[model samples]
Target: MTLTTSGPSSSSAPVAEEDGRRVRRRRHSRYLLAPFVFTVGTAVLFGLFFLWPGVLGLSYSLTDFRGWGDLEFVGLANYLELFQDSEFYQSLGRTFVYAVFSVPVGYVLALAMAVALTSKGARGKTPARIIFFMPWLVSPIIAGVIWRWMFGESFGFVNYIIQLLGGEAVPWASNADLSLFVAVLASAWGGAAFNMLLFIAAISNVPQSYYEAAELDGANGWERFWYITLPSIAPTSVLVILLSSLGSMKEFAMIQALNGGGPGTQNRLVVQYIYETGFERSLVGYAAAASMVLLVILMVIAIIQLRISKRNNAW
Candidate 1:
């Protein structure tokens, strides 16, 4: 075998043709220098946290993994078994329901709160924003645990209020239907502030010219909002919807703590289901399949949102 290698050649002319050696060189230089450092940094972080876990999950998905001895190669058996599981389907259905409730509701509430606080020269805006965002800063696990206490059957502050009002205290986290309702409510409460702050910043950055022109046209508050405010913050809305949908579908901590996924698994979020299947049940391969199923669902919804929102953005 013979190896021929060229070291950095100081005598060569730099290439410059568009779509040729030169353009490629230019693109390579411009996009591939400091960006290479960033790419490496990103790769390291992603590999450590995300990509490595994903690769492991994928490999596990192809085997009859029980986390001991040799993992038997089972191809798609885990997936097929997951699909056949009634609990898996119910958990998935519940996840979709959670997404339907949480994503849009969170976006609307956040947008409204953001609009309110971001009103030009609005007083107390900073304080209100801080208060709204406080929930987001708290750990999700802690929030779930706290909410569980607040919504618990007998001692819950919520039911206490209902009882004081001469209404019967409803079991917020104990009933099948009520647990899902409470989970949605808790998710919205905990999540809104974070998206609200994003919206506030996005709206604030909108050029004042849009609002000024709307006002000069004798537009009322609603009219100004419809034309100026909505368009100005449309991209932020897209971002919030995309992120919240993904988060909602995989929600676990709150739902798990709130009612342990049910009065009978009626409130089982998909992540909890995956956790139960993998760790609790020692079906790691099955859990991996569930994770892939979630990824596909999220990708489908994300693609739809991006296309629809991008088209709407053009209008």
Candidate 2:
């Protein structure tokens, strides 16, 4: 015991422990270094690209900056004028109508395709899926062009068939309503494939036992789909509707290519209006104001949908 005198100094034990802790801290820092660097880099890029542009757009909306010199701040004049603009209101109304029609049409088509593709009695699923999904792969502009040709009043395949059948040719180009209808159908046809893919994934994840149990209970095909399949895929349905609504509201390229917002601007949508105002008319600040309003509308829709989804989930 007395000979334990110099085994080691108490201070030496504490020094060694401190050194060990320093080594562990260094090791921990090394482990975190890569992730920290990547996160910082991503944040910087996001701020530079997205956040900065958004802030700049907001600033432009408050000023009379016509994409030119001397940004004179006009307070809320742009917004006030936007509220009183009849053209803006008309464009917004058309956008709302398009969204209302297109979203449901696309949703129904996609759901039907998904159910058919996923059914046990289905045949040649691979080929059918490929054909259905081809529209989604095509550019919206090209899709519009293709549809325009098909529905063209003069040489269109549809009109040709109608003529052969001794029926009047539809005025898809000259009549605003018919043009808008064609645009709606085109949008649904082009967008359905993408939503179908989403529904397919959701349907696949549904528990097979529920369907089997429903069958055992003598549930018919329609009953099984209405009760079991639809309820199980509610979340996906909500997602598809939200996406379709947003896309329809912001539709520009397809409609522009198809009808040029034509038949005397009767089919022009909000986005097309904004584009014409900002670039075509050189009313950058005004267009920015309109864009901000559209942004608010989109935000409101998203918030409402998310709230509804949350409530449904809670129930």
Best by TM-score: 2
CA lDDT, every prediction? 0.85, 0.94
Q: lDDT value for candidate 2?
A: 0.94
lDDT of 2 by residue, 1-315 (tens): 355455567759989999999999999999899899999999999999989988888888999988888999998999999999999999999999889988998999999999999999999999999999999999999999999999999989999999999999989899988898999999999999999999999999999999999999999999999999999999999999999988999999999999999888888999999999999999899999999999999999999998999999999
The clash numbers for all candidates, in the given order, read: 2, 0
Clashes of 2: 0
TM-score of every candidate: 0.86, 0.89
Write the residue-wise lDDT of candidate 1 on 190-228 in tens digits: 999989889889988999898888788889889988888
Candidate 2 matches the true fold with a TM-score of 0.89
- Candidate 2 residue-wise lDDT at 115: 99
